[model samples]
Target chain A: MRSLFHEELETLSDELVELSRLSARALERATRALLGADLELAEQVISEDEQIDALRRDLDNRAIDAIARQQPVATDLRQLVTTLRMSADLERCGDLARHVAKLARLRYPVCAVSGELTDVFAQMSEHAQAMCLRSGEIVSAQDASGAAELQQQDDTMDRLHREVFRILLEPEWDGGTQAAIDATLLSRYYERFADHAVSVAIRVVYLVTGVWMDEQEAASRDHLGGGGVPRAGI
Target chain B: MRSLFHEELETLSDELVELSRLSARALERATRALLGADLELAEQVISEDEQIDALRRDLDNRAIDAIARQQPVATDLRQLVTTLRMSADLERCGDLARHVAKLARLRYPVCAVSGELTDVFAQMSEHAQAMCLRSGEIVSAQDASGAAELQQQDDTMDRLHREVFRILLEPEWDGGTQAAIDATLLSRYYERFADHAVSVAIRVVYLVTGVWMDEQEAASRDHLGGGGVPRAGI
Candidate 1:
């Protein structure tokens, strides 16, 4: 029975890795739809987000059932609880990706990102994907060190987020106000996508290194200044 | 012993109500800071967010302890798990409130919001505060009916969010790109603040009605069109 319970925990971990991969693929497709103006891909991504939500529901119910049946304590209970939070982060990643896709759908026939800004968004998408993928690896391998590196990964996303603003506020910006609003929100979708990945990474650190006496303690050092995309003062 | 476990669960509910109240105050003050350009109030809201984080941590630890010591199953286990999720949502409400405060601080002497849009934001802020405060009441009273009403409150916020975009995109918009960007992000912070409140209110609905077979089932109906902010197309 004890071995079965541990095995259940292991399955939960594996499923979390699966959630990461699902969100990563969704984000990749969403970015493609955004950049290429591919209406089909955008619709595909929007429709498929429900899958991530469903998988999360399954994982959550199973985790709760395990806690109920196994009566897990200490390390065991923490793992189950942490899985719930990680699943939530991954689900939000899917939602953020869907937001990206929806913007693509909303701006169909016309590319949402115009000109040199497209390159910045592509770079941000790449970095966000890497963070999401690595979060999965960190969870699967139980690598506290990889989780530490994932925390740093958000810096690139933050920089890219600020770059989106820089372009939006530039005197040469001809994209007009609608584009500016889209870019502001689109940049946030990517930035928040990375933030969710970092949230998952930190949970892994807590579970692996046992340094998380409080989630806030680990999180205090964890802000990549990603939360607020504060301009250099207007 | 079972009664003690239930009592612990009751305390978790009370604390979640407290968290909702904390975030409500934070949103109220943060909106004040944003509209008034009160640098000191912005700083105060930013600094005071830590207390919400700390309270959530305390609540999480106690819930985990309740789970570990009592080894609760069934309704007891679900209530504990829901507490954790509600605390997370309420904590995020505080963070969203802080984001609003940070934007206020970042913009400093110059008001982040400009002209007519200020009225829209004021309405959004009031609506957000109402949802959050009502979420606390719903949880404390275990009022599923009130939770239903809280979900509808998001429509006003969504309308206000779109109004922010409409103003930014209009030909008459004199606010320029920097203000456009600030308004976009600020509108999102308020919209998301209300979304988190809705998230909590739904959790209460689940626990009270036992209708939450899966969180996504209820959440599918819960979108409020708030996630994407899709435009009328470019």
Candidate 2:
């Protein structure tokens, strides 16, 4: 019974990790669609949103069922609940991807963001993608170091997001105000996606380490003058 | 031991319902601040957001702990999992409330949504608030019929949301285009709030009736006419 229960827990983890992989690809495709102005890919992302939604629902149900029927104790139960929460975050990430695809449709044939701004967005997308990939990796392997790396990647995305907003607010940009505003909102969506990825990573860290690394990191940073801290930051 | 387990489960449910109530109030107060241009209330809502976040994180840990320690049976496991998901949906709903409060801050002293459009937004807010309230009621009472009522309220919010979009897209309204666009996104945020409320209500319906109402409703609608169906009419 004990081994069977462990096997079931492993199976649940495997399914959740699969959903994370699907979610990562969805975001990547959405970013590609936005950058390349590919309506076909955008439409595909929009349609596939239902699949992501279905997977999220399925995973939640499975996690709940596993917890109930198997009567999983302690760490096993934590794993199931974490899977449930992560599934919702992944679904929202997919929703963000669909929102990006909607923008693609709105600004089809011509990219909404152009030139230097486009480079910023592309970098932002790459950062978010990396965070998503790292998050999934950490969850799959239960690697605290990988999860920590994912959190750092989110900081880079946040910095880039601030830069994107600063450019949008500046009055010097003479052309494409509406498009820039749209891109501004798009950047926020991508930034939030990265935040959610980091959120998953934080959970992974907590799952393995049994401590809220972000909170502890923040506390440590505060104690160290907020900037002099090495390798420890929220 | 069994009674202790039941007591913990009951406390979890009660705490979640209380959190839902607190969230609903925050959303309502934030909307009121917007419609009335009450900055003080908006500030209060902003401050209260921290409490909601704290409650969310607390409930999250408790839910995970419950699953970990209790080894709940199938239905109970589903309940715990649903509670976990509902907490997330609730947190996002709180974020939307904060978004509304921020809009109130940005466009203060004067109601940004003006003239007939103001009336349209007011109606939308009314419907959205009603959904939020009904969702809380249903959650507290575990009333399936009340959950269905909340679903109908969401349908009303969706209709008002579409009407707001229509006004924004009209060619004649160009003077306050920036404000109009902001209002457009604001209405969307509220509409999405209603959507999340409906999601929560649907989960309540599932918990009470052991039937997934949304899927069944969609199936019936698809068979009936293959066109847009009113969610309220379901």
Candidate 3:
């Protein structure tokens, strides 16, 4: 029974990695669609998000089942619960990618990102994709070190996001109201995509270390009797 | 033992209502800060968010404890799990409110929203607060009809969000890129706040009716062997 439970846990971990890869590819295609004004790629990304949603639903159901049947205690329980939260974060990432695709489709033929802002968006997209890929690796390998590196990548995305905003705020910006709105929303989509990736990575760190990313949070949890219900010894 | 479990469930429901009230007030104050350029009010909203976070943590811990100790099955189990999800949505609502407060602070003495956009934002804020308060009532009473009404309110919010975008994209818009960015993010914060409130209300509907908001999802779940693992009719 113990071995079977371990096998189920491994399967859950593998599914998360798969979901992460899907999210990364979706973001890649969505970015390409936005930059190149590729309506076909945008449509594909939008349609494929349903698959990501289905995968998330399946993973959630499986996690709940594992808890119900195995009655996993302590660390095992935390792992399952954390998996549910990570899947939610990844699913939201997919939704953000779809939003990008919708924007690309909306502007079709005329790139929503115009002028010098294109390069900034291109860089942001690359950073976001890299962060998603790294998150997948951390999930499959449980590599706490890789999770730390993802945070630095997220910082780069943040800087790029601010750069997009700064350009929009410049007096020389003559992209007009439509362009300003497009740039503002697009930058946010990429920034939030990176944020969700960072959130998943942080959860990974917590799962492995049993320590939250926020030091104050960790201390508070200790005061709350170890953050969750005390499980009976298996 | 059954009576004790019921008592715990009632306590969890009450906590959810309290969390909902906190979210509503946060949105109200954050909006006031944005429109009035009240830095003190904005600071208050931002600082008080930690208390909301703490309350959500406490509720989540209690729900988990109920699950582990009582081992609730079927509807009882679904209710507990759904409570956890609802708490998360409420916590995110608090975060969105904080984001609005931060925007207000970023602009300081100068209002982030200006000109005709102020009225739109003011209306959106009212809608968001109304939705949160209604969600609280629905959660406490399990008012399925009230839950349905909240969906219509969310629809109004969605319409307002689109209107904000329309005004931003107007050829005559001279709010400057900074104002445009501020309007875009602020509108989204309010829209997302409404969205989370609607989500919590829908969860209540499901908990009471076992019917998903999406009929197609319900059909799909039915095909997945009664939606979750088959409990042994405990």
Candidate 4:
């Protein structure tokens, strides 16, 4: 019975990795759709998000069933609960990706991103996709070592997010109101995508080390200029 | 043993209601901070968010303990899991409120919402607070009846969100870029706060009726415009 529960746990972990991959792909396609003004691709990302949502529901049901049937305790219980949260983070990532796609669809052939801001967004998209892929690796390997790296990547995204704002705020800027709104929302989608990836990685770190990563710890380490230890908190 | 488990569930429900109240207060104070440019109130909201986070953690731990100790199945298990999800939604609502307060802090002494937009934001804030309060009632009573009312309030929020965008996108709009960014983020924070409240209410609906409220169903009903029945989905 114990071995069977472990097998179920393994299956659950595998499903989580799959969800991460799906999220990464969604973000990638959504970014491509935004940059290239590919309505079909944007539509695909929006529709495929339903699949991600379904998979999350499936994983959640399995986790809940395992808890009810097997009654996992201690570290095992933590793993199960963390899986539920990770799935949620990943699902939200998918939604963010879909939001990006909807923007692409909304703009259609015109392209939501202005010419000056395109490169920054391209870089942001790449960083977000990389973080999602890395998050999947961390989940599959159960290795928290890569968690810090994900935070750094998210920092890059944040920096780019600020840059986008800087461009929008330029006094002589002429990106029009529609372009400004589109750019603002687009930047946020990428930034939040990276944030969710870091969140997933943080949960993996907690699952492996049993040390809860509080917001202040993550904020201090990632946003407050680094090298700070993860503060101990429940 | 069963009676003891039920008693624990009641305690869990009470904690969730308390969380909703905390979230409502956070939004209230955060909005006041934004409109009045009240630095002290903003700081209070920011610091007090830690308490909300801690309460959520405590509630989550208790739910996990209940699951492991009682090994609840079927409806009982669903209730416990739903409670966990609702706590997360409420916690996120607090975070959105915190984000609003941080904006107030970032623009300290200078209010985020410009003169023309202040009334819209004020109304949005009030709607959000009311939704949070209603969500608390739904959780405490396990009453699904208020769920529709909560969604209607969210619709009001959604319309206001679009109105904010419309004003920003106007051709003659002269709110400086800083004000625009501040308004954009502020609007989103309030909209998301309402979204989370609706999420909590939907969970309460599911907890009572066992009829899952999928995103598409809610979207079709809310976005697709009135009288649409909730479509069945897993």
Candidate 5:
């Protein structure tokens, strides 16, 4: 009976990982639709959001059930709780993707962003997708070092985001103000995506090292102000 | 042993209620400081954040310990997990309050909002604080009806938020752009406060009813204009 319970707990973890991957794909596809101005893909992403919601609910229920039936202790309980919290975060990411896709579909014939900005955004989007993928890996492997590296990975996306702002704010871009707003907001979405990825990485770090990183401690560090966005309330 | 476990779990629930109450107070004070432009009060809110953060971490650790030691069943585990998630939400709400306080301090010298609009915002703030208080009550009592009332409570905040837009866009407010921006952002903060309060209410509804409120169902009812915010996925 104990072994069976262990098996069930393991299954719960696997399901959570699967859900993470599902969200990652949704983010990637939705972002691609945004960049390519692919109306079909945007519609597909918007239509598919319910599935993500369904998967999230399933993971939540199963995690609860695992805790009840398996009665996982210590690390296992932490893992289940973390999985549940992470699922909530991931589900919101899916909603954000849908939000992006909806924006794309709403402004279809009038693509506000130029190809130049799209290029920069594409790079940001890809790096953010990579973060999501690595975040899942770190969670599954519980790798502290890899999790630490996720922060560095996010820095690249941040750089690209700045590049986006630089291009959008140029004096020559007067006619593009509306598009600029859209691009800026899209960059925010991507940045938040990376931020959530970093959150997952921090959780992975906590899982392996048993040392939860606090933002207050990090804030105390004298920063050279290299422009890395500080995690809020780490 | 079972009785001891139940007792410890009960203590945890009590502790969570205490933490939630503290959080609601912090939010209220922060809102007041923002609306009244009280820099001293804002500073107090900022300084008091450490206590709130510490309480949050304590509640978190205790919740983890409870789950680890007691090994609760599904229903009990859901309650525990919900508490953990709600604690995070409450902490984030405190963070948002701090955010407002930060803005209040930065935008010092108190720009006066238009008379009628300012009155509306003051009332909105009161309603937000009330929602937070009611949310706490519903959580503690596990009162589904009270929780559902939060949906109604949010409408006032939302209407005030829209009215803020009208105030800002008025032709006479030409020089008030910056103040308008500040007010709009402040409104956003309160709007989100009410939002999270509704979310806590929905969670309570879920806790009691065992039936999760769907976004569509919420939209049909149209309380928060589709009430609950989407859960963020990992």
Candidate 6:
């Protein structure tokens, strides 16, 4: 019976990794769609988001069923609860990716962001993908050791976010107010995507080490201070 | 034992309502701070946000412990799972509220949003508060009937969001790109805040009715179309 329950937990963790991968890839394609103005790719990301949402729902139902049947307690039960949360984070990552895709689709013939700014967005997307895939590895291996590295990666994402604001607030910004809005929203979407990945990885750390890391500080959502708001540090 | 478990469920439900109220009040105050440029009020909301976070954490821990101790199955187990999800929604509402307050604080004595836009923002805040308080009532009563009304309120928010975009995109507008970005973020925060409230209400509808409401369509998140992005509707 215990072995069967362990298998259930393992399966749950595997699905979590799969969710991470799905969300990560969604963002990557969404970025390509945004930078290259690929309407087809953008539409694809938007439609495939349903797949991620469906997987999350299925995983959540199974997690609840396992608890009901197995009557898990202590670490066993915590693991199941944690699975629900990690899936949610991944699902939200999918949503952010879809938002990116939607922005791409909204701009159609024209790329969503200004040409000069694509480099920063592309960098942000790359960091987000790396964080997401790393999160998957942490969950699958049940390893907490990768946390420090994840934090460093999150810091890099924050710096990139500030970089985005710098370019937008620069006096030479000829992108217009509309483009500024797009850049702000786009940067936020990518930053939030990376933040969710760190959240998943941090949860896994708590699940494995039982040291109880503070999840709220998973990544600094407070990192961005837009416009005249004194962008967080140079 | 069953009665005791039911009582535990009731306690969990009550705490969920408290979370709803806490989040609602936070948004109300955050809105006031934003419109009034009240740094003191903004700081209050930011500091009090931790209280909301702590309540949600405590409630979730209790719900998890209840499931472990009672070993509930069927509807009982589902109720516990729903409690966790609803708490998460309310907690996110609190985060959105804090985001509003942070925007306010970031601008100090200068209002985050300009004078003319405050009417729309205030209207959105009112809708958000109504939805939050309504969600609390729905949860406590275990009533799904309010779902329709909640949906209507969410519609109002979406309309207000579009109005913000219209104002930002106006050719006569002279608030500059920084202000446009601020307005954009502010509008998104409020719209998302109300959306979370709608999410909570819809979850209760599912819990009580067992009719399996399609929650993804709880409210249209795809409503906004910014810049040259062809705002969704007139």
**Model 2 per-residue lDDT tens digits across residues A140-172:** 888877766776776687667656655654556
lDDT of 3 by residue, A71-91 (tens): 777788778878988898888
Residue B104 in model 2: shift from native, Å?
3.8
CA lDDT of every candidate: 0.84, 0.68, 0.79, 0.81, 0.67, 0.84
| Cα lDDT of model 4 by residue, B79-136, tens digit | 9988999999898889888888877776777776776799899999999999998998
- Residue A74 in candidate 1 has what lDDT? 91
How should the candidates be ordered by DockQ, best one leading? Answer: 1, 6, 4, 5, 3, 2
Please, what are the lDDT tens digits per residue for candidate 1 over residues A134-199? Answer: 999989998888766876677777777878877777778898888888888888889888888888
Q: Which candidate, 3 or 4, would have the higher DockQ against the true structure?
A: 4
Scoring only the A-chain of each prediction against the true A-chain gives TM-scores of 0.94, 0.87, 0.90, 0.91, 0.87, 0.94
lDDT of 3 by residue, B1-234 (tens): 999998998999999999999999999999999899999999999889899999999998898777777777778878888898899999888888888888787777787788788899999999998899889889999887787688778668767777787777666777767777778778777877887888888888888898877633322221102211111111
For model 5, state the Cα shift of residue A45 in Å: 1.9
Give each prediction's DockQ, rounded to 2 decimals.
0.60, 0.18, 0.21, 0.31, 0.24, 0.48
TM of each candidate vs. truth: 0.95, 0.79, 0.90, 0.93, 0.80, 0.95
Query: For residues B1-234, could you state the per-residue lDDT of candidate 2 as single tens digits?
Result: 779877877787677677667777787788788888898998898778778778888887787777777667767767777887777777767777777776676567766566567787777766766676667677777888876677566657766765665565455655343454456557656776777677778888888889888754522221101111111111
* Model 2: residues with Cα > 4 Å off, grouped in runs: A1-4, A106-117, A146-148, A163-181, A215-234, B1-13, B35-39, B57-70, B103-121, B163-181, B215-234
- Model 5 RMSD vs true structure: 5.6
- Model 2 achieves a DockQ score of 0.18
lDDT by residue (A82-155, candidate 4, tens digit) is: 89999998988888888888878777778778677999998988898889888989999988888988887876
Off by over 4 Å in 5: A1-10, A33-40, A106-109, A112-120, A156-187, A215-234, B1-10, B35-40, B106-124, B164-187, B215-234
In terms of docking quality, model 1 is medium
Model 6, A1-234: lDDT tens digits are 999999999899899999999999999999999999999999999899999999998999999999988999999999999999999999999999988998888877877676569899999999999999999999999889787688779889888887777787787888776777778888878888888888888888888888767665652354334222343321
- Two-way DockQ contest, 2 vs 6, winner: 6
lDDT of 6 by residue, B77-151 (tens): 889998999999998899889888988888777776875798999998998988999999999998898877888
Q: Over the stretch B1-234, how does candidate 1's per-residue lDDT look in tens digits?
A: 988877887888899989988998999999899999999999999899999999999999999999999988887788889999999999988988888888888888999887999899899988998899888888888887886677678777777887887777777888888888888888888888887888888888888888853355345432314534545546
Scored by DockQ, the top model is 1
Q: If the candidates were sorted by their lDDT against the true structure, best first, what order would they fall in? A: 1, 6, 4, 3, 2, 5
